[model samples]
Target: MRLVIAKCSVDYVGRLKAHLPLAVRLLLVKADGSVLVHSDGGSYKPLNWMSPPATLRIVSPDDVELEDGVISQWIVKSTKADEQLIINIYEELHESSHDLGVDPGLIKDGVEADLQRLLAEQIELLGVGFTLIRREYFTAIGPVDILARDSAGATVAIELKRRGDIDGVEQLTRYLELLNRDPLLAPVRGIFAAQQIKPQAKTLANDRGIECKTLDYDAMRGVDDSASRLF
Candidate 1:
């Protein structure tokens, strides 16, 4: 990863046009050629970012830019889309590159898996008579969190996420596409269940005809506890 702290201004074009006035900020260039511009705050979310499969080109300031005191510029162009991010650097405060090796990916400490288990046992959370077929139901791409049949006996694939985002919707879409290809599950439907879902994700899921369910984690745990006591 390459990190730079500089006084810069940014302009983004494609789908929308946005401009950021001159400010001291952090610019991050990832190993995959992704770029993120971040302010001092805002947690981990970047103020502006371009995803991977992109190219970054550093260009010297032209005459006009030099006259305006611009020293350098970085142009990041997307390979997968018609998007571009241009950062005009006036002064560099710091710059460094770190050779961080391969990442091990995130370790889900059973929060989501536990939620899936509780939902599977209380399958009726989906509807009055929903029945669980299995948990960790295998598909060609990956194991779906849960698979069940709704009250109407229609196959339903449930994808559980702690915080639903657009990517989660996309993942569920792929699983549904694959699951529906089987003759027995030819008409499989999808339900995207999460503790909290973003509006954009909900809209996308709904547009794709996927049902969105907001899960109550505490309530689910309560149900699990009640069931355990009886057993």
Candidate 2:
């Protein structure tokens, strides 16, 4: 059976729509499976006139095999969170089909992007101004995630995390030490932003004057998981 994969529309907001919105063409696999179609103007608008239903030809013995292949041209806007969500979505799709190799780098990039976006939004909502410095630098411990400005005009060092981890304190401590040592970042505050926190680590942080918090995705906000503030 010949599978004619129909053209579909994907929007700038990362939403998949039936018809194209404006002049932008949707990203899709060509019917012949020879090439992938993508939008050049940041949006894809599907043709309004209804033509024959788009179909995908099945050349394999099993119809399920048709859906088994990875998307050849996974086109995504270059934003970090958007790319991460795409990788996650792709991972789920691959797992369901049990036939795709996920790129580790891609997954890491996705995760970092998600963390960065969440942290940025949290900082903004919390009334803390910040800047994401995309500079290349090395440290005795490692690379710092984000450097921002606090309410007092002091530099702030922030690290983003997706889940609960024990090393957040130690990790932030190392970065904080480095920041304190640096003539430029010496006065900056150190912070760790995660989806959750560890108990003992939080206590240690409070003793040391470090700040740790959690970002609640469902609530669309940040919660102070600081030990000093909690108990």
Candidate 3:
């Protein structure tokens, strides 16, 4: 799957329109260990200022796994909604392959972990940091696909898409809310990186301070290299 990282809301909206019927879920994860899922035809009506948690999973932390189709969809979704979020930290390690200064095998290991090692390596060279936080609730809502953090410790959320969904911002808004309330997290910031976003929804993000960005997965393999160098 390809990925594109855009810088603004307008682009995201346009791309979303070009894609539709996105067979994905919208997930909401809380810092207190709560998980919620909102897949197609799932009810998402908020009650008393909050939505209730859907089916909860009982799985070990280190034993994280996903079925194949879901994983593909997740990779696409995460690449769009949260570029920095899904990228694993190991991808940022710097090592030279040919001179044996760095083991090529190690780089391969990073990839096996689903870390964008090259992207991580480049971003670190540019002085940025990233870590992936797996939240079960997001998987329930739909799938977070990707969640990222910058060097200064800001959150950048991405939702990957092969087609557009109308609830992109709404889904991201929930994640943002959860992130902002976390005491252990650095100051939270959010961006909805989508193949597209709804028009009025863009206005809502603007009115509320959330940034909406667009991605062109077909044009890029992963997150943009610019964010690492735009000093």
- Per lDDT, the best of the predicted structures is 1
lDDT of each: 0.85, 0.46, 0.39
- TM-score of candidate 3 on Cα atoms, chains taken together: 0.39
Let me know the TM-score candidate 2 reaches against the reference structure.
Answer: 0.43
Give the top-scoring candidate (TM-score): 1
Better of 1 and 2 by lDDT: 1
* Counted clashes in each candidate structure: 0, 14, 43
Deviation of model 3 at 156, angstroms = 3.0
Q: Which tens-of-lDDT digit does each residue in 181-201 have in candidate 3?
A: 433453566655445667776
Instruction: For candidate 2, give the lDDT of residue 70.
Output: 28
